[model samples]
Target: MNHQDHQDHQAVGASVDRVAKQVIDAGLKVHRALGPGLLESAYEHCLAHELGLRGLPVRRQVPMPVTYDGMELDAGYRLDLVVINFNARLFRDGVRRFAL
Candidate 1:
């Protein structure tokens, strides 16, 4: 990669790290407030709420489609949550993405 592209990649990676930290902290706060007596769905909703309160955009229960030979298939993969931001992984241009 060129120097500019390398710098951009570094910036995106740093951003992902920072956002992940924020999300982790938010989830921890939720867990601390409400102990582990609830269902997974409860934790999921609360985490989303907490992140939203922090002004972060979050997508939940996102469908994951597998592609093969220009065909997209429903492979039963799903992301529990996706936090959208410049630091978040993007799959545009047929690129594989990392979790944030």
Candidate 2:
């Protein structure tokens, strides 16, 4: 990549890192407030709200499309929460994945 492209990539990476940290911190706050034993949906809702309060745009129950035999289709797969601008997805099991 050219120098400009490399710089752009770095900027995006930094943004992602910031968002990831915020997400993790928000999650910890939620867990500490609510503790364990609640349904996953309850945690998902609380975490999304926490992230939103932190100024991140969050989408819940986002459809995840898949490619099968050269065809893209909605296979009923859904992401628990997605931080739209940051391209970060949080799964039901408390895993975070970035599409960078």
Candidate 3:
């Protein structure tokens, strides 16, 4: 890649890293406040709220589309939480999936 392209990629990576950190921090805050034993949905809602309070746009239960045989289809797969712009997917099991 050219110098400009490299710089752009670095910038995007930095942004993703920042957002990921924020999401992680927010999730921790939620967990610490609520503790364990609650349903996954409870944690998902709380985390989304916490992230929103942190100024991150969050969408819950986002449908994920898949490509099958060159066709885009809704496979009933849903993301627990999607932090907009950064496209960070947060689940209750502390497993993070990013579509950056």
Model 3, position 35: C-alpha lDDT score: 99
Clashing pairs in 3: none
The digit string of per-residue lDDT tens for model 1 on 1-100 reads: 9999999989877877777788889988999999988998999999999999998899889887999899999999887887874543544432335454
- Candidate 1 stretches with Cα past 4 Å from truth are 68-70, 85-100
* Residue-by-residue lDDT tens digits, candidate 3, 1-100: 9999999879877877888999888988999999999999999999998998999988899886787998879989998777855433434333446653
Q: How many residue pairs clash (N, CA or C atoms closer than 3 angstroms) in each of the candidate models, in the order given?
A: 0, 0, 0
- Name the candidate, 2 or 3, with the larger lDDT value: 2
lDDT of 2 by residue, 1-100 (tens): 9999999889987877888989889988999999999999999999999999999989999887787898879989997887855433533333446542
- Compute each candidate's TM-score over C-alphas: 0.76, 0.82, 0.81
RMSD of each: 3.8, 5.2, 5.5
Using lDDT as the measure, which candidate wins?
A: 2
- Candidate number with the higher TM-score (1 or 3): 3
Clashing pairs in 2: none
**Preferred candidate (TM-score higher): 2 or 3:** 2
Worst 10 residues of 1 by lDDT: 87-96
